[model samples]
Target: MIQTEIYNNGPVEVAYQVYDDFYHYKSGVYYHVYGDKPSGHAVKIIGWGTENKVDYWLVANSWSTTFGENGFFKIRRGTNECEIEENVVAGLPKSSGNIIGGFIAFLALIFYYMF
Candidate 1:
């Protein structure tokens, strides 16, 4: 299931974030499909940013809006802008070339546990 795929990335950082893929769609999420299995979607990539305004997430999508900025979703930061249902900040991808991301994540977990 999508949960397993999301969990595989471990507790620190996630490659994708699992969400109910039946309704909500936005930037940063990737859809998963398997033979005869119920598929779910996940938010791919973490620590990545866009040149757009910080209040919104510049997402690239496969929708018909491909001709222009419509191909993307300006997801509200610190908030959810859902077509039907709002999504939460599920997980984030570690930054590319992030040799120390794992270490930071580990330290974060330790710090969380200690607190």
Candidate 2:
């Protein structure tokens, strides 16, 4: 038998001073590691990565593709640069179109199986 354990912890409050500092952005990578001051804004962590032996996290931004890496950017991992790991939000898969349409499709599947 295989055993597994899960840990569920709440979000953490982090500080970010370089919220508008995009000049440091290059090739879709965000390397802002100076902002020690706190900001009221927030971001979400989508994934993680390792480049040149440096761990980092893949973050999504609201600025759209015009921003960095088609609206996505990478930050140094572990240290929680720009507070990317703190106050994080998990995104859900978007529905096809509308709730009614999804419901209708679900019902059709159920009916087809029953009849």
Give a tens-digit lDDT track for model 1, residues 1-115.
Answer: 2234335653222212223542345344323232232322323211223334454444444445742245544434443433211322233455666657656765664454344
Q: Give the TM-score of candidate 2.
A: 0.50
Q: Give the per-residue lDDT digits (tens) of candidate 2, residues 1-115.
A: 0001101322222223355465346554566645443333444555566877877666566667876787766777777565444433222225544566645654554453345
Top-TM-score structure, candidate number: 2
State TM-scores per candidate. 0.26, 0.50
In angstroms, give how far residue 112 of model 2 lies from its true place.
51
| Alpha-carbon deviation at 3 in model 1, angstroms | 20
- Model 1 residue 58 CA deviation in Å: 1.2
